[model samples]
Target chain A: MKMLGQKNNRDNREGLKGWLNPLRYGWERVSYWLQRLTGIFLLVYFVGHVFETSSLVGGRNAWDTMLEMTQTTWGHTFLIMVIGASTFHSANGIRLIFTHVGIGLGKPGRPDYPYYPSSLNTRQRSGIWIALILTAVAMLYGANVLLGGD
Target chain B: MRELDNMTVKSDKKAGCDPRDDSFDLKKTTLRVFRTNTAQGKDSHFDSLVVPVQRWTTVLDSLLYAKSYLDSSIGIRYSCRMASCGSCGMKINGIPRLACYTKISELEDPVVVCEPLPNFPVIRDLVTDFTQFFNHHKSINPYIQNLNYDKTEKIDEVSSSHSHRQSREEVDKYLQFSYCIKCGLCYSACPTVATDTKFPGPQALAQLYRYYADSRDAGKNRLNIVDDRHGLWRCHFAGSCSKVCPKGVDPALGIQLLRSYMLGISKDKRNV
Candidate 1:
């Protein structure tokens, strides 16, 4: 079957700009991209975490050295990033759950000219706001813990 | 003359223009339209043209004006200039909108960027090939499959039976989804369809749910049709399909309801 938007050689001239056009979309699209990105980051981090923790099998000295490396500035920054991704992923996951369960969807209405917002639309917007707020709060707490003067 | 007068009046009301006004407005607007002509071997490019736009001038009207008066080479597919035909679906200022329904004045941007709907093969400037969209829509068997309909009876006479009659409440169940004009706008706006071509897409899946939700439909095995891979599970519920739908058919909501049904959690009263 012929697929739509299958890029030919001429169409292939444009690089990542087509998929990653930052200026062409709205906040919902931004959140969608970020959720995928964070999920990827979490997957990579999970593998690295398992490997890092496996250092304990090499004896107490190896474990101690691995722990020591995680206390530095760069390590703290990486940990903060991990915290942010986890928080955002969890919050957004909740939102996805709500959508999948049809929590906010009621009677579908006619799309008014000039665009009237629906109940599901409002719920999705609030979900994004809540996710953003939770991510902010989690990031700030992580930053305070890592950057605080002892 | 009378028919033309009636048409003008009806179109004016549909376009949200004052019917009393006979003269077209002289206000000009900038349109940055994507242009491509494979037959002419011309590379895809953005062409900007300034055209006079009235308060009632739709995006489709502006394109028509540009084609007729300014550039004759530009290609666009449109018919029935009303929203009913579903032929004028395009990305107006990065949103999948029906060109016939979108007013030029309503767009807040100074320069309106017109592009072909995303996730579809561009045939030319603002023209997309909808063959695959229709194929996928057809794959789901969109018609109401009444397994109980006796082939021995005349087709029209089958409705004479009182059992085939649906209550007002039963009609209300799938009534919202019956409004789908199959514009492919939902397919364009769907992020899943953008990446995964194997997915049945929002339009098809929504139609599947529409038929499944109908009380008169005796297709009890319908739920299992979309239960396979790249079906109900592929939709991530980005909600873009519902948001950009010109007809207000919330395909995202339909997909979610289908998902809930699959998971045995749907509150929908319809028995499978």
Candidate 2:
């Protein structure tokens, strides 16, 4: 995040076109916070999962009862949110990895100024398309599951 | 008495003068150290203390005194009291350095500032999570690979001259960086490692280059191992790692060398 600040803060703060015009800063913060939050969430989930699995020490009945409670409405809904957040966090992390190493999606001959173009080419826009597609699929599945269709 | 190297105070008496005429008292100094714990919930606050500073007193010495006398539960880590153990590294006045090696009296101000090493999870006051550092070190396979199989045949030791000649400069490069002690000061100082965990880090990358430089080792695929986007490419040459290295090992140079090696810019890429 400091690296981004060093390179982009001047341009980042100067923009006033619209709320969406300077989306990179918002996205960067969101991704960072979400990744950290999701990581903590996963850690908590792991601890709870291990504790729940320890119910096997009691008997098969305990394990079955716990499983039934976990498959209840609230539990299922929480699981869905976890899956979605985890996936988004992972994708954003990978993207960050690429960007940090100077992997520009733009062509080699293109000028480096004004990092993002006014219009993105097919290659430049592929990652966004992929993320949108994945989100759409996940939303559809989530609605289906909640509607008792899956 | 002759003045010791790096000593700031001078003896008042000349060669034949009486010692009783002059007196020396310890200098009163204030230390400002960052304070936090799990119960405190990450809102780090500063705590200050005044102590008498002597010529040979180290920052760690003051910290120890504070912990034992001032506050027993002031969390910190230390192993071998000497700098060899590397467990006592932290940020002193915004620079990551071994606390054991830094003298308290030499600092510009008595108001000493301290913080946990950056680029790592802080466990408590001065104690940081070194799990990531150790894991990265292990990832490079920090050992000699034994390839020869002998049922009965025993091979004589290779000539030291041959091995020595090949790795002379390479050994110098490795020898300095190899003394990292896993203290993680370089990792803390490095901006690249701070932002990107997958960057292999300056310490690990230096060790990576060390393995590639070994004459006994044939690491042909070394370049391939760390050539990815998450590897050498992420280093932006901030030079912070070199600035704070307690062992005087320039990890920034190692990362640069690795980058040049990956980009085919150096003449001795194979030799690293």
Fnat: each model in turn? 0.20, 0.00
Q: Give per-residue lDDT, candidate 2, residue B110.
A: 57
Best by DockQ: 1
Q: Could you tell me the lDDT of residue A126 within candidate 2?
A: 57
Q: Candidate 2's residue-wise lDDT over B1-272, tens digit each?
A: 34562232333333323234354456767878877775567777788877767777898999888887887877889977788888999888766788898898777775898888767677788787777677777767776443443334433434422333543554554555566677787777664565565666778887776666555565566566677788777665444555556665556556655565566555574444
Model 1 pairs in collision = A5-B121
Whole-model lDDT for model 2 versus the true structure?
0.62
User: Which candidate comes out best when scored by TM-score?
Assistant: 1
What is the TM-score of candidate 1? 0.85
TM-score of chain B of 1: 0.87
TM-score of chain A of each: 0.82, 0.59
lDDT of 1 by residue, B147-232 (tens): 67788887668767535677776776677678889898888877777766667788999898888888777776777767877778
DockQ of each: 0.29, 0.01
Clashing pairs in 2: none
Give each model a TM-score: 0.85, 0.56
lDDT score of residue B55 within candidate 2: 70
